[model samples]
Target: MNNYKEKQLEKSAEHYAKKVFKVIAAIVFGAIVFGLAIYVLMRLWNWLTPELWGWSTLTYWQALGLFVLAKIIFGFGGEGACKPKKGKKNKKKWKMKCDMRNDFSDWKLYDEFWTVEGEAAFKRYIENHKKRHHENEQKQS
Candidate 1:
């Protein structure tokens, strides 16, 4: 019984140590990547600006500050962004709207709408439509 408990304790300790090591390694890697990006940005800014715009080159921290500032200014859309909601009712509503918009898609059946047969059909449809409108107007009158 004591040996079993000792083995379980060792296993738990090892599991926790591995978890902690992974978290620490991820943090260190993220920091290194972020610092390298900032250095590269500063170098590019220094290489480009002075030649093209007569602007002074930026240092590492200044470039990092500019990046953060840009993110603060333009990165977040707050609430104005249209995001797709996963609700069934919203999906149904959006689908219904799309279906309504596409109700006339069947009218695009002809490659050339002014084809000879299509023109005759068009005239028949228009005459029928006008007759219905005339009847409606006469009834109203």
Candidate 2:
């Protein structure tokens, strides 16, 4: 293969590796968080309701299995309760003109903005937006 083709293949492999790493990292992180939450919940339950802890005891493996079963049932709404759909739906249909535009160019504007004044400006912008959002939510409530 030509040098250009070889370089393209190398970059493609790198991109694929990066995407796979991201997916694996997300799964591992999610598992850790879920385990931690379960542990905390069990500790809290034992602390708050000592009587329940003595009624019947489950081993670590049994507790883990029960937790998984409970998650599958409640998380997926096995009892037919009202369950919100996961993930956002793309509602707005873009026109062909909008589709034709380069997405990188839009991203470049933010890149240029941050580059001009360093990250402080971007950080301030995020903080201001967060504050505004909080205020708006408070007003709505």
Candidate 3:
């Protein structure tokens, strides 16, 4: 029993160590990529700006700051892409707001609604509007 427990504890510790190592590796990789991006941006700015626009070349920190500012202004990731994920309940409302494609599935029912109730609703609205306008004119007079 003691041996089994010890083995189990060791296995758990190994698993936790592997997870920690993975997280550390990911953080290191992300930092490297981030530094590389800043370096590339600085190099490109130095290569192009002084010759083309007579602008001052950016330093490493300035390039990093500019990248951060651009991200803040333009934002990150697919914001308005509107791809619905699994388990979202308000799918219809989400699609209506984000989907700009011309062939919206809901529009297919528009003709049906217009034939059934839209025309009657419009005439009723028009009549009510005219009555309100006439009443306003009379009150003004």
Query: Evaluated with lDDT, which candidate comes out highest?
Result: 3
lDDT of 1 by residue, 1-141 (tens): 999999999999999999999999999999999899899989999999999999999978899998789889888556332434555357666767767766887778666666858789989999999999999999999
Order of the predicted models by lDDT, top scorer first: 3, 1, 2
Q: Model 2, stretches more than 4 Å misplaced?
A: 51-59, 77-141
Winner by TM-score between candidate 3 and candidate 2: 3
TM-score ranking from best candidate downward: 3, 1, 2
Candidate 3 segments whose C-alpha is farther than 4 A from its true place: 78-81, 84-96, 101-141
Error of 1 at 72 (Å): 1.1
TM-score against native, each model: 0.55, 0.45, 0.63
Q: Which portions of model 1 show Cα errors greater than 4 Å? A: 76-141
Least well predicted 10-residue stretch by lDDT in candidate 2: 79-88
In the range 1-141, model 2's lDDT, one tens digit per residue, is 699999999999999999999999999999999788777766665555558556554555666777888888868445232222345244233333345553455775876777887688778999999999999999999
Candidate 1: residue 134 lDDT (0-100)? 98
Whole-model alpha-carbon lDDT for candidate 2: 0.71
lDDT of 3 by residue, 33-100 (tens): 99999999999999999999999989999999999999899887674557777787899977886766
lDDT, residue 94, model 2: 33
